[model samples]
Target: MRQTIRNVSPMSNEGRNAYVIEHLTDALLTLLRDHSINDVSISELCECAGVGRASFYRNFESKEDIVRLYINHLFCEWADAYEQGDDKPLSALIQSIFAHFERHRDFYGLLNERRLIYLLKDVIIGICGPKPEQSKDDAYAKAFVAYTLYGWVEVWFQRGMKESSEEMAGLFKMQGL
Candidate 1:
């Protein structure tokens, strides 16, 4: 049976596109539970999502693109929550990062289990990586921070995330980072 699509108003193009995106994302993730991304086809994904092929192409270039989009969406959500919090210290930021991952353990765990966590690296870098216009030193600093944070995340996932967010933040604080 096709999964039920939600939250789209019948007449709005934006709503319809959102519906397509949501369904296709769910479809791809569901499919991934049983098949590798390479083994999943566009036709199969479209069928599973209950959307036409044209609908799929209109919203995403490929299955990986859908996953990337979803990852970005999740980060945007975390950023919103972070911005709302008053404490903006480095340790707090680090703790929030770990907390966000802990909150989304199932999705992140799936990525880890399926070896798709590499897809998260670019998204993390894009969100915090250096901009092209920055000076060499500034660019290097940003790159260092971004890659270091990604390293923490990767290692945490690989280790089955035994540490709590507060504990990880404490480790970072102890390191004088």
Candidate 2:
């Protein structure tokens, strides 16, 4: 049973991919609030989104891929919001990230509980981008940064996010990152 998806603008020429991604993301986030990603089946997700099972496969390799693609989308948004000649401080970037996550706190909190936060790894690496001058050590540093941020985010979500996004940003600022 396929359900029609509306309200999605293709982020790329891959209109079908974009459509599936938007609907799948909505369904996954909605479901993650109540269930672990590991427990989510493709059929259940497709049913929730009113999308077809074949469509889901065409857009995503697995359930975790949805989270990764969504994170990619978030990173693209953050990058787009940047201004040329801007300092682009790490604190500013981290703040934007935390603030964005705050908007979907419940969804991420559940994912953290299920230890699916590791899914952000690829997204982080992608954000690191391709630096021609990047050395092996730089690659390690990038991975370290990604994993560290993931840990802090998981902790924040697990602790019920008592700190406001500003406070979280301040914490990083104080650490000189």
Candidate 3:
């Protein structure tokens, strides 16, 4: 849903805060897709989000701040699902993540670049907590997960999202992440 951060009572600070967070998320996705992460500017972002500069600064120091918040929301949901103690929880967790990438296909496409994907993986790992094993075996697991989902989303989009989400999830699970 589109978000608006204006017209709410200033006294209801909590609601206003939520409004700003959601608003910035929508704007950031559009701006990043159009101008990319490296080119997007704070003024342009605030303009797209329809929030004032001061309000933007109040909520996010920069575009990355807003982007990080949105990623964390997805991470928290995935973590919660994985933490539910299902067999092969990591697979279940990967399923939750595939759904997320499916939603943000445009941004996921941008992450096809290896550098961007690794950067994203680091951010996600940092936010999601409980890092993977610090062994040679597990070193690439987190990065691989991020890259796989991003690439999968690109393929799904190009293929017109032909499979149902669960079907795609199952396909991803079979990949043995």
| Model 1 regions more than 4 Å off | 1-10
lDDT of 2 by residue, 9-43 (tens): 43564876767778889999898877888788999
| Cα lDDT tens digits for candidate 3, 12-62 | 777877877788788878766657677877778778877777778788877
Candidate 3, after superposition: displacement of residue 24 in Å? 1.4
Better of 1 and 2 by TM-score: 1
Local error of candidate 3 at residue 112 (angstroms): 3.7
Task: Tell me the lDDT of model 1 at 41.
Answer: 97
CA RMSD (A), model 2: 4.5
**What are the runs in model 3 whose C-alpha is more than 4 Å off?**
1-11, 87-104, 113-115, 123-177
Ranked candidates, highest lDDT first: 1, 2, 3
Each prediction's TM-score versus the true structure: 0.88, 0.73, 0.59
Q: lDDT per model, in order? A: 0.87, 0.75, 0.65
Best by TM-score: 1
Position 129, candidate 3: lDDT: 30
